[model samples]
Target: MPLFVAQYPIGINSHVEAIILQLEIGSDDVCMLGMYGPGGVGKTTIAKAIYNKILDHFEGSSFLENVRDKSGTFDGIIQLQEILLRETLGMNGQLKVCSESKGAIAKENILRHKKILLILDDVDKLYQIERLIGGFDWLASGSRIIITTRNKHFLQTLRICHSTYEVKELDDHEALELFSMHAFHKNKPEEDYSNLTDQVICYAKGLPLALSIIGSNLHGRSEIEWKSALDKYKMIPDKDIQKVLQVSYQGLDETEQDIFLDLACFFKGIYKDYVVDILNSCNLYPVIGIKNLIDKCLINVDQFNKLWMHDLLQQMGREIVQQESPKIPGLRSRLWCYKDAFEVLTENKGSDNIRGITIISPKLAKLQLKAKCFEKMGNLKFLLVGNVDTCGDLEYLPNGLRVLDWSRFPSSSLPSNFRPHNLLVLDKPQSPVILDKIFEFRRKLEVPQNTKYEDNILMDSHSHRKLSHQIDYSSKIDFSHSLIKPLSTLHAFMMDSIMDYEESYNIIVTGKKIPKWFNHQSIESSISFWIGPKFPTIAVCFVFHLVPLKDSYANNDKYGSIHNDEICWNCHVNIFTNDHTQPLTLQRDFYSMKCDHLWFYSNSHSKFQRFFRNMMQGDRNLVEISCKISWWSSRNKKFAPVIARMGVHAECICHPPNSVIIDDNSDYFENVDDSSDDN
Candidate 1:
């Protein structure tokens, strides 16, 4: 048999010793060992290592690769027989698969008396292996057979397998060494890449194939390139590794495949029983499908009975969904990412192809929901949202929904026409829609420290959104849980300000145009608005296009894409009464954005019970806002390498007394040039 090549063979000696011990070469009884693991965990590599290490001990040996790839038909099985016989017995190339127990005892007896070692690699279906090579009775005493499969159950049930070797993922140290060998041409990462190396290892999660492919993909790349590649891999996994892992997934039936994808997209880490219940409601036959997934090593149930999947496999599933409709998320069967879900609902782009959606903790301060958003999502069976601020109550819902777990539902009751006949889980945690107390503050509002203002202003879908909970009111959302996110919120400054202000405006950039709601508009770099008793409190909002920073290092093809937690654009909103006075600047902070997006420094809660009454008393003082955007790292942001790329002027709007209105529509937006671009 031609020897198999084991790439980056780390930790193979122990495996070879274990397999050889299981074989028991000196024993009188012949043995067949089953080797199993998920794809890319190095099952084939270990088998090859075992084969090369012990081939000298046996008189005849054969190592057959990719039995799964060639087992599609009886002809393929016959081909596998030919290779096995030719390698083990020096027989002619022609061989036939036995239709019954040992086809032609004369042919089978050729190896029955010879002490041989044989390996069948990548066997998906056990029946194929059984038909190609019968039980150990056909082999001589002291002979050994080792068969490898992705499905552990295949080995567990096969009585002929005297022992089974469950090949586990590489340990951290070995994984790092193997990865660095490909990534840095050394046994360890370069001096300054310890953290980056750790991140790669963590994401790869000990899968040898992922390590090798990702390492090679990032080879000779700069730190920035590594970061970019890592970010992209999360969104779209390594194509080669994905291909290797998808073989097992493709072996599943249609319903099993759906269950696997569902778990990958939304159910990972959820209790196994809970997942089975939800999937059962969808008529997916979850009991059997989940079992199939477990048997195939697609998912695992931990001690708590929660489902866990390999990170690469989960990413691969999501990428499969994304590939269905690369440019339009609405056309895909599932939606989990906040950006994709937000875009589909806000743009009214939902389609019947979408089967489920889970939108959690949207990056926007307030997410305004309209009733018509789900009009086209007739096939949507699962919907879950948490920490989402919506304008008002939902007016409609489909009857086919099997799961509806929405936090912060804005209505006092479910839609009048909506029915719960098909509902399985109606989860509403800390919801205030049942008996909410809607209170109106005095036109003058003062926010005390350690107190939360209502979020109505942020959720209002009308013309006058309230400052604090302008309309949607339950709890105040805080960014305190995150390290870098605090630098992006107005609440960071609201609690400690020396002077009491009625309102605070947080900045966000999206692929949305500026709404035509502000009374005063400007086309220049700055805007002036008059605030009076009729409209004392105000919030600044605008949109700016992202133009490239000239001669900046972060202008490569993948530079615009980055981890939101690590990088951001520092924007300054300077407020001035006139040119002679120093501006009362909105404290400098960072917000994540994309190049095609517009900037909107919008949403605030609470009425300023106190304002610059002295400054506002005469001549209807015009509050001038000058906004500029620059790129910066979340780390050492104060000393950021600034690139002045955008200058946007925002129009200020006053909140009314009773009801709040916020129009998140695409209208009356005048595009301002991103002056930072070389163009």
Candidate 2:
């Protein structure tokens, strides 16, 4: 038995011991154990540790490293079987089994009589296992065979293992300790380098292989060199780590490879089903391709069904795309680097090879491109532009586009000749171009503190033209009309101001009415309703009317900044029914610079049905439903949230016997004059 050479196995002890317990190697029965996880998760290292620990207890032991790679060599499986036979039988020279019959003869005659421990490292295919180990029946009782693979499906399909263990990434403490050992030659960092050490650990993200490679590369380097290395890693991954991760990607087929690249470039952290739908429209078998990726430990789907990949693996995939025409941004299959994507568009350097492009810039800059920039990108399928003001005629758009999520689009309208016949999703949020007339007064509003404008000034009535110059209702009407025509071809759509925690836009709308599609409507903050029996469907709506700041306050520099007095109103709705002791609570945050309403509806009945059952408990008689709404302002100590008019609406299959009414104790809308002072 030969000892394995692992310098620092910080997190492998627990995994090895747990897998050993799972295998129950002490039992008299023959056992086959499998260790599986994503690439570079330390599966082989743990297997090697286990093999070396129990080698002396067995009659003989053999560890076959890199079975997936070695099998591709000349007569690989045959040579592997011969090596296994010679090691277990205590032979001195290499045993040559050129043919299948010869290999089987050696396996059955000499190797079957002894109790042996065999470890197969990095097995990817089922045929490799079949040819290498055949069966446990041929080995003596109490014998054990361990297999380490990236794909769990291979083990299930072969049925060669009685137990399987998934090797997880190292925890924070273990990752830091492991990284410190290689970087600083100790288990803990010195005081001066503590923060730098933490940054390195965060970049590694608890992946042992990444930690090892980076730590070793940065060992004994100065502070300046460490900082430079970390900065470089953001754009380009360490080559040593990328080489290991890229092997799994290389094993994928053509369509699967495309799916992987697309996810790496654009769809990471997106909902898996949503990405699958978009990819399916592009003729990619995302359903099977995603499964394969998961099996290979290249990607993971969390409990929320959102797809996530390790940062290193994602970087590796992007690096692969980056290497294809490294100097020429136009020649790559995917363009995600902001500099590259911007250059490709502004310079008309895009080519037919470009499949996807994402431009996300934090700075406020207008990207002016020639109208024919996308003319050559006929193969483009996915396009996402965020926080970028794109201008130009844009006379032509590719007909094969599947997703066009351009936030803050600069054009007044899409070109007439541009056709998106195959488009599946169109998300143009905070679209200033579509609502040019409504947003024109965003910077010029000078309303007094106590003035009350007529509802028709902003409402959907013909009288809207009376205030056309101050606020154009015609543009709003045109915007709404133009938006409705594209709903037939889209799978999902959203149109609203984009507000994050740090900043908000100045755009505001004065409308206060809910959409007509909502069957029930209310203007008060809280409402109580009775649901009759057999009401199958229910939908909820929330409408908030924003009050603009006074001209005096807006002009003052100290108070003018939106951040100084900006308040984020968080609304919580509590639903009470007669059946349950506790009320069901739903919460949403409203951060629009202007007035906005949120509608909650389900295209599928299952989600609504589940919600209805949980809230109503299938009661046959009339059930009282009460919703209480409250709001709190964020970051404003003196500013209180006042509801000019808040509403909750419920839609169902049939109307209740009694009409919805406000709770007598609730003072949501009563004494409107005093309510403003209370906030």
Candidate 3:
């Protein structure tokens, strides 16, 4: 028989002692004992202590560590077979899984032993127990199965004939004793600091983990240092484990410490692969660095690849990061919700102070931007906005703003004054207000009337080479309940401003239903007469689907590639691509049909043409927009010939309103000849 690790058995409290003493002895019904508590609360520790004390009476015993961390579906069966085989049958290496046809393996193994002990520790779910030992009539008359778990409800639902015991924090005396041994290196506190010791114990809150950590941290430290440590407890709001845990955290390496802080301060409920990607991107990997982090007990990787940290540990990490480098208030920070963000922005007009901004959620109410911060940020660039509803209004834009992106916020209507010439890319992803507003605004801008009208503006089936580029990166999505509609309007206004003022534009719109205002006529006319003067070519691409290549977004490599069917109607052309990387098909049309314009329209809820704008150059005088139902894409093909185009710029660049000739009684057909002759 193997010798098990010895544990402290003296001073066992009545709560745990009573439960242990009530175990069924010599009963025909199998005896089961369940211990449950919160994570890191000593459920597993206590179970081992009790099991070792009683194992002498048992013919066999086995302990399973971290059964909750198993990965596959067969973890329960494999665990059960291993425990029964080794403990009951004394099976060593080269064990075989007994097939179901050779059933009763568990019963046979257990029946062979008179008294046995089986400990299943860290049982996360009830299915683990039911699959492992529920139906097995394996135990002899005096045998016992001891189970330990964090979830109390799991034990109750097990339907086992087991006595349940809830483990709690140690009392003050026991906690003091534990703390003194670790901190003072003795069973009692030193005479010089006895008073401070008591206060430390009080802050430790009778938690065994807390006592051990604080004790280990304070060992051999000076009296003044001890007093400072004790006083620091007052600063801790959740006086459970954070203060005590901080002592242990001081010993970790810079890298391990950094990984810890990132887990705590930035990402939670993140999968392992995603964290790996981020860590790798930061060039933080060293030999066995992550595994060493796990071994140090700074981080915990669960069976499902999810990483978790203790609340205290998380707080400690956040503090470390904050202390090292506090985020500047005016620097760009990703925003998640509109109300909270607007509240912050509204309180401080950070528009001037903030160098860059990215808003993820769409709901920005009017008051959020009222802050005086905007006036201070004169060098601001890269504003990414999203999560707005269709009718939301656009707030005022800060001057010197570059890269006005709306892929995050989709809108139906555009504000009139949103003209940013330096703007380079616009992605609506759900609204056509950009194209519509541009068509309407161009007519309102009224091109000089002396330029000659070009006849080759209408698009057929043309191919044009279009450039692609990525835009500003941000993860903040607006989560405000009040800003959904307003945010949409805000996006629409910005996108419209781009179309009205900027030359060189790339717009992405996504939706399943077309907007009521975006008709076939608008698509045709905008592709022709409404193309911008400085940059006339546009490529319209549609993203038919968006499927995540991986299950998580935190990973950069895990991405959903955009699939687009790019069309250049001006030159009556279609782009053919084996990979769809470069949609120069529209560029082909720009040269072939002598058309330098493009317009895109789709049903509501489409994400087409996003990739094209994402790949554009930052220096280009362009606008990237997303709208409710329509978008535009255009790029001059390298192969397209530049024509010396002559045009009498129309007074109104957009479609002109029809008015009757004042003095002539000419019929409609006769009037058409006169108009053709004038052209």
Candidate 4:
């Protein structure tokens, strides 16, 4: 007999021994054994240990993990069929679906395997077994199918020629041994801590998972620390094993709290670095925090840095976070997608109740802004925009803003002047049209100049032509390649894409963002890049857009020329060029044609305007550059900004670009009488 090295009482000793007994060549018994229990109850472990013990008697053994988690039902059935095919038949052949049904294939394959031990993990639905192993005739006299499950009725409904056994919890002695190894590193608690150990054992209630967690929680602590833990245990409200496990979670630091919640709610079986990346977005220290979790025994982190928590623990953590701060503003929480964000904001519109908002989810159904709701947000600031149709109709923004990030907005139609003047940080200001609007706003708001309008007009004219060319291309091409296309249709296409992507692949990247290629350098260089003719690409042509400037510098060398003279505006980056499309000066009124692209922005005392041109005709690459910010207060915390995405539009937009569009007063309607307005 193989040694039973595992100390945990997995509760399948009898079944495993029965399988071994039946596997004898002289045994005439044809019996199937099914081991079942709730998730995380050690069914898989028991079956494996048993299988290893008796594999020598059978021709082969097979194991399937997450049979129901795969993409297609047909795929799982085929996988099982292939296993039986190669092992029992000693023939390597792919199972082809003729009439292509899973049931037919399963029926044919099960009869071919003889004296084989098959272990199926996480079988939940009854139909899954019926389609795979419903038939009884296929089993050889000693063949066995050992199934593990969270639902017992799932097996009872199948009602095949199989007897089921419920794997129960460990007894006190077995639980104590498991706990002692983890807690005191001995067979029993240390002499001095016997009383506290007894208290811990009573809380564990003979459950293996609970004992294991409690033991690890108490590991290496002094007697005082152990007493402190015991005191905490006595206060647990539910006194359930899960509640006891949650005590470890409560002991985690604030960062650990956020990381744990994010994992439980957002991802499972996720790669380590991917989790790290998500945590890094919130400027979290995942490395140290994860180690703390592993050491506390609340979670497990493998050599691959893949962190996993017992489902019970995960459920507890999620419930605690949600219940404790159901409505606390700025409390650490997550928005699953842009739609969730919109739903929250829309549901709570006109109230200054929400404290902070994060746009963690990328893909969202398109949303059209209701004019009244846009005008009512008096305190909104932090926003994570997605590249989907959700950004359309965004105009007015709260003036008390600190951060503006449009990296999530995939396209370039966002208005300028969206930046609040007191804004401290601006990231990825790549669109030229938006940049120009900021500079224009800054020039008007900060630096009062009467003659600067003409200079702004000159730049606007240049950008106008480039924009027109792209619009012309869009008009000429099929429906897909237009930039100025209506937001509604784009949203519909996106919705269809979501369904298609979901059906075909299990992986979901949160943002509905299309890849962007245009950058500041590419725009300034007048280099054209195309995304697809189906998608309207950024057109690369330089035109003069208003820019916020620190000082007035002219490209013209001549000090007194009337037409090519130095035109001083709040322009930051230069809009002049060696070659003029016309006379390098326009005699006509440029603002007569409304340029939604024209913008103005301000950064403290300095300002600049970017004259964004057209889409790059070919491929343009967004150059990745890293820079760090130092905070003197938080131990001089320094971190680089993630260069999310970049695009080229035109000239300088000031510090905090004015991306807000003025709303027409006709749309504002009040539920109350005008008495409140008068008051």
Could you say which candidate leads in TM-score?
2
Model 2: residue 605 alpha-carbon error in angstroms: 12
- lDDT scores in order: 0.62, 0.64, 0.45, 0.43
Error of 2 at 137 (Å): 2.5
Question: Residue 310: error of model 4 in Å?
Answer: 15
TM-score of each: 0.63, 0.72, 0.37, 0.33
lDDT for each residue of candidate 4 in 18-102, tens digit (9 for 90 to 100): 6555445456455565666544455666777876776667665666656655414566566665654455444555645443265
Per candidate, the number of residue pairs that clash is: 24, 0, 108, 73
- Residues 314-430 of candidate 2 have per-residue lDDT tens digits of 899889998999899899999888899999999999999999888877566789979888999999998888767777777777888877767656555556666655665555544
Ranking by lDDT: 2, 1, 3, 4
Candidate 1's error at 27, in angstroms?
A: 1.5
Ten-residue stretch with the least lDDT total in model 2: 483-492
Measured with C-alpha atoms, the lDDT of residue 500 in candidate 4 is 13
lDDT of 3 by residue, 198-300 (tens): 8877765566766776777789999989888767754443344655456435545777665665556433444455355445433457234566555444566
Q: Native-vs-model 3 lDDT? A: 0.45
TM-score attained by model 3: 0.37
